[model samples]
Each structure stands twice: as C-alpha cells, then as structure tokens.
Target: MQRAGNAFVDLIDDVFDNYRQFQHSNDFQQYTSWAKQFKSKLSHALNTWIPKASAFVLNLLSKLRTSMTAWWFFLDHPEVPPDNNLAERSLRLAVTKRKVSGGSRYN
Candidate 1:
C-alpha cells in the first residue's frame, strides 16, 4: 500500500515538474507539446488501478482532470501567467498593508 501511494505521489511530482518547466519556458510550441504529453501521461496514470489508492488522491486527480481548460490558457494568451503565485502574493501584501494601516489608527 505504501509503495502504491509513493508511486502515485512520484507520478504527480513528475506532472508538477513538467508544468513548472512549461511555465518557465517561454516557447509556445514547446509548452503546447509538453501540455499534450502531460495530459496523456496523467490520464494514463489516473486510469491505472492502484491497490490502495487514497480518496484524497482520487479527488485531487478528478479536480485536475476537470480543470484542463484553464491549464492550457497560456497557449492562447501568451500574456497570461502560468500560475497564480504573483496574484496571491499581491493579495497577501495588500491585506498585510491594510491590517497595518488599520491598526495604526491613521486618518
């Protein structure tokens, strides 16, 4: 059971590595190719029967499969960000600033 879980995690890590590579690489053709290959590989991995697949992993994979449309948005819009890290960070910073300002009791 542990072995099956580890293998599933490794496959997921591979997918994430491929995604990060695609995100970092500015080549449109390469990203498209990687995305197609990643989708195929992930689909195959998800289809494989694991002896003791956890519900969490199964649900995660289901969510990923359903979010395919948003995954490849970068292909159509080169300006689109590959991840939401920047936006998330900006929001965090805004919240921090607001909290600090509110606590400071500035006019």
Candidate 2:
C-alpha cells in the first residue's frame, strides 16, 4: 500500500513536469483526469485503511487530507511547483543570519 501511494505521488509529479509544454494545450486535460483519479484513490485508501491505522498514522493522514488541496494545485494551476522546497530554502537564510548574530533567546 505504501508503495502504491508512493507511485501515485510520483505519477502526479510526472504529470506536472509536463505542464510547461501542455498548459495551453489539450494535453493538460490528461493531467486533470489523472488528478481526479488520484484524489479518488486517495479517498478510497483512507477509508479502507485509516480505521485500522495507529493513532500517529491517523493524525498524519488527517494532516495530509487537510492539506491535500494545496498539494494538488497542479489540478487547478499546473504551473505551481509540487513542493515547497524553495520556500523552505528561503528560511535557511534567516536561520543562518540569526545563528551568525547571536542565535535565539527566548523566555
């Protein structure tokens, strides 16, 4: 099941990777169809397994389900990156500056 989930994610990434070439063409409809199918599979997986999952896994799934729309931006706007790596990297500069200065000091 985990492998299946991973494959689904990879498939979504592969679909989005072609967005630049397809954004303005009918090819994008293929991605839209894939996105809807992925959502259905995800929902089915959750319904089938979540009840038997551990508490931690349940919580994690809750978070994923809640944030799924944001992650599925490719469905509505395929131009957006799939991950927040750039936003995360932007925070490194602030962290480095703080460390260079004096580090955090809070009560």
Candidate 3:
C-alpha cells in the first residue's frame, strides 16, 4: 500500500485504521459495498486490458479512487470518529503504563 502514493493509499489506510468509523453510515448502509465495488473495478481493469502492466496500474488507480469515495460514508456519520486517531491516541495509555512498569510481554 505504501508503494501506491499517499493520496491513493490513505483510503485503505483509513479503512483499516478506522474501520469502526465507517462500518455504518447515516444512510443506514455499510462500507462493504464500497470496498466490493472498488475490488470489482480492479478486477475488470485487470481482465479487460491486454497489457498486464497498464492493466495493473489502471486497476490500482481505480481502486484507490473508489476507496476514497467510500470514505465519504465516514463523513456522513456524525457518531463515528473523524479518523482512527481516537483509538490510536488512546493506545498511549497502555504504552505509558508499559514504560512506567517493566514493559510489554517482549520487554
């Protein structure tokens, strides 16, 4: 995903990072279809284009665009977090405790 450019990768990154925020929407729909449609476009691009490299790029770009569109569902939902920052920042509590104590399981 990192190889895909920041703008393109951000959507999937947000999806995985902030899945809870987009699981549901004000329209009473889930984000599942967005992901599904994104995948379908990628598949079609790959299958339709004869040149493999061009097809792959076209697919990736298309998927990235669709994923970004899916992010709108998050904006539509007022109850969900803006991003995954809520959960991410919350994790500091555990990390701080670990630092104060001996450490995590590995540490």
Q: Write down the lDDT of every candidate, Cα atoms only.
A: 0.65, 0.69, 0.53
Off by over 4 Å in 3: 1-60
RMSD of each: 4.6, 4.3, 8.7
Candidate 2, 1-107: lDDT as tens digits? 47545755675566556564565675767767766786787677666656766778777767767887876665676667566779999899999999998888886
List the candidates' TM-scores in order: 0.56, 0.58, 0.34
lDDT of 1: 0.65
- Tens-place lDDT per residue, model 3, 1-107, is 33334433554565554455454443334555554654555445434442433556766655644674464444445365546787889998999999898786662
Reference-based TM-score, model 1: 0.56
Cα error, candidate 1, residue 75 (Å): 6.1
Error of 2 at 101 (Å): 2.6
Output the better candidate (2/3) by lDDT.
2
- Angstrom error of the Cα, residue 35, model 1: value is 1.7
Poorly placed runs, candidate 2 (over 4 Å): 1-27, 66-74
Error of 3 at 11 (Å): 12
Q: What order do you get sorting by TM-score, best first?
A: 2, 1, 3
Q: Rank the candidates by lDDT, best first.
A: 2, 1, 3
Q: List the residue pairs that clash in candidate 1.
A: none
The deviation in Å at residue 68 for candidate 2 is 4.3
